[model samples]
Target: MSSAKYHQIKDHILTQIRSGQWQEFQRVPSENQLAQQFAVSRMTARRALSELTDAGILTRTQGLGSFVASFKSQSSLLEIRNIADEVRERNHSYSCAPVTLESIDAVAPIAIALGVEPGEQVYHSVLVHFENDAPLQVEERFVNPELAPNYLQQDFHTLTPHEYLSQVAPLTEARHTVEAITPNQQMCTWLNLYNEEPCLQVIRRTWSQRGIVSFARLVSPGSKYRLGGHLTFTKRS
Candidate 1:
């Protein structure tokens, strides 16, 4: 199968899903169907679907055919978590690449979030997290220098900021604000998302013994990741 033809198959599936033409858990065209439609061999069609499946865009069962995966990955809004641990728990391979790491003068909204004055210097870092080699999350964070000194020195690829922060200043409290967002081009590129795909954003502020430690914006393609938790209520009568 030429790359173009296979890419066409993959692109068709992706387009349907992103355009809401196909709903979650809906079964997609079978290998034979795709083979006939694209005039390609069954092997080629199967490979196309396999690629999507590996990318967390589809789920294939033994007897049943492939269906769009359900909110492929998840995170808890109630607790601060190490993304690496979350991915490992799902039995998926996890990796990360730090895009930006440097010191910057705090600006308005971020300064307020980190409780630092506007001219004060703070550590700023941006990274992308991957699951099974597919980009899953874009993490942009600002750290209070007073709280986590040497913030820009650590290797984020090996030790995520979440993990390093935990070791330096165990989380004592946290706040999370989540919303749906339209990602900018750069963020879309980082998450390997189409421009029209919806994204979930979590603006988080974490505190430790020292005070507000970090403020982070965590964004992921809505199709590939989700955020929620199980909660139980007691009778209050």
Candidate 2:
């Protein structure tokens, strides 16, 4: 089948879901139904459904059928709101201590994350976040200059990188990973953590309309911070 036909089928289904024609966990049309409706082969219809399933917008079962995935299932750590906002929401004062802010040559790993060539000049910033004068998180970030040209000139003391980037570029997607490790000497000093204290490290990559926007590593002392959020789940009938 032509790629356009399959994509059209996919877009139709996505429109239904987005338009609220399909609710969470509601079964979508079977492949046969879609094929008949779109005048495409069952294989083509299946390809569209398969792609949506892989994208986490739908779920498929062998005996049943494809259904709209639960909203919680599509949730990602990258979707978490800005840290400064989170702190203020808890009625605490938030401040950012600038540690490093400059343009640097991207290394291989940074290049891979930003989808840029190695040695390309990128804007880098490091800030230790504080809540009421006690350090809480170390935010190390690199920005794609192509996406946010004035990244280096931002007054982070008054506005966070997260806030700045959101204004400059519209976010399209985000990726996140979490790990646990002991704080290094630099991290220990910044976060007021002991060397043996484990830290929750969250690495995030964000994309804007242009392309990859920024890559960030956030470290919080495990004893002082924990990641928590409430997710609504549909009860099965």
- In the range 1-237, model 2's lDDT, one tens digit per residue, is 457888888778766765678897999999999989888899999988975664445677879999886543122644567889988999999999999999999864466567787689999999999999899999999899999999989898989998999999977777665667677798898988656799998777787777888888889998878887677779999
Scored by CA lDDT, what does every candidate get? 0.81, 0.81
- Per residue, candidate 1 scores C-alpha lDDT tens digits across 68-102 of 76542233347567899999999999999999999
Over 4 Å off in model 2, which ranges? Answer: 1-78, 232-237
User: On a 0 to 100 scale, what is the lDDT of residue 137 in model 2?
Assistant: 94
Model 2: weakest 10-residue lDDT segment is: 70-79
- Provide the lDDT at 100 for model 1: 96
225: Cα error in model 1, Å? 0.7
